[model samples]
Target: MNQGVQGPADTGVPAARGRPAAPPAPSRPDGGDAGPDTDRERAADPGTVRGEHTHSERPLPRPRPAVQRSSVRGQVLDALRTALVAGELAPGEVYSAPALGERFGVSATPVREAMQQLALEGAVEVVPNRGFRVVERDARELAELAEVRALIEVPVMLRLARTVPADRWRELRPLAEATVRAAASGCRAAYAESDRAFHRAVLAQGGNDQLVRIADDLHRRAQWPLVGGPARQRRAELVADAAEHTALLDALAARDLEVVRALVGEHFAGSV
Candidate 1:
């Protein structure tokens, strides 16, 4: 969540950031950008002899210039990731870059670039002419990710609960409280972000950046929302989840390892 949520300055890209971000560049005068599905052309029937075929192949549509402000790419990537987590980009369904570009009010070039990065991260897979498809995971795979997170995070939390100074754990109260407020507000975007932030802060207590990063990756995968699930119910579930964070903080502050372990286990169970 933090990865693609930053401004251009954070990334050191020659891109604009802040309020009222720069407008997208205009389409090339050379007619490089495709104007939606209006330009669709039927493929020639290869079964027919070349001489007999009346259909001529249209040149592939050229994507606009790729020198877009990196902020655009960051915004597109964040929006795409939100769609994935919100189930708008259903797992296993093909989504075209041009279509998504139109949805985000930008050229297909930057959208395609963002999708390429998602592909590299295993969030989506390239589909050749079809664009990309969100990677699907079954119940077992989701559970496996949760288990890996617990394996990586729980021990560190256990250690920190007893060894960390009381003030250090107390210092994270605002982040934990933010998750609770977000959960109560019933906004998936707010809750999802605060949830990640809360866990990330907790994992950071371990003082191992690598472990925190690995656990954060697992946390993202494990929390990918289900397609066509009930939103109201998910909100309610988030409220219940926020309770776990409160309990975890309380347990850690009290240095109760047994309660902390149980709270962590229950927090991860049936998640995502």
Candidate 2:
């Protein structure tokens, strides 16, 4: 007899020298094969275990926040305002949101949102079941806006002039200079924004938030192009208007209330 493990007598095949043979597959109730060992299969898969529920060891990525809609709406609002100031959006003309959206390469939703904001600003009005119509602001309305702004701003600016130091007014020189440059650029939208910035900076010295807000709103209304007026203002006209900002700053720095009142009055008069 051989001193090692024997082969099957019926098959007449010898066993391997060093390695053990794989175990036979288990039998099912119907005597069919039960396939590979589930424990060994689970061990091979990183996401699965022999006894516990399957899960990944690494964390799943977080979902990103939605920012495109609001951002697009803001962009559309700014563009619409600029178009209004630039006279691209004609007064009394109706514009559908879908048409504007097609031009802007976005959906109609953001355009409608922007148009609604414009409506609140008195720049446009809603047309029932149609679209938005640009408001045809008359010269008298523009003049009234300027008068209201002067009424609100002149007193606050004078009070600030009497109390605030020269250095504080000097600090606003850059803002005034910005208006001059924007005016020279001949972009009505640019000058409008810069002009408001200079005025807001001056009124902010009064430390009254409501005064600034009201004055700014009036200033914005006055900046819009009036009905039957030139589509774009002459560069020289814009430059002349911007120069008043620097002059106002000079008078404020000198604490000359008389000159401040005169300059403020003349500025409002020229606004029409």
Tell how far residue 72 is off in model 1, in angstroms. 1.7
Please, what are the lDDT tens digits per residue for candidate 2 over residues 16-134? 76988656655544455556565576678755545354432334577654487689999999899889888999999999999999999999999999999989989999999999999
Clashing pairs in 2: none
- Quote each prediction's TM-score: 0.72, 0.75
Q: How many residue pairs clash in each candidate?
A: 0, 0
Off by over 4 Å in 2: 1-67
Say which candidate scores most in TM-score: 2
Candidates' lDDT values, in order?
Answer: 0.78, 0.85
The candidate that achieves the highest lDDT relative to the unseen native structure = 2
Model 1 root-mean-square deviation: 23.7
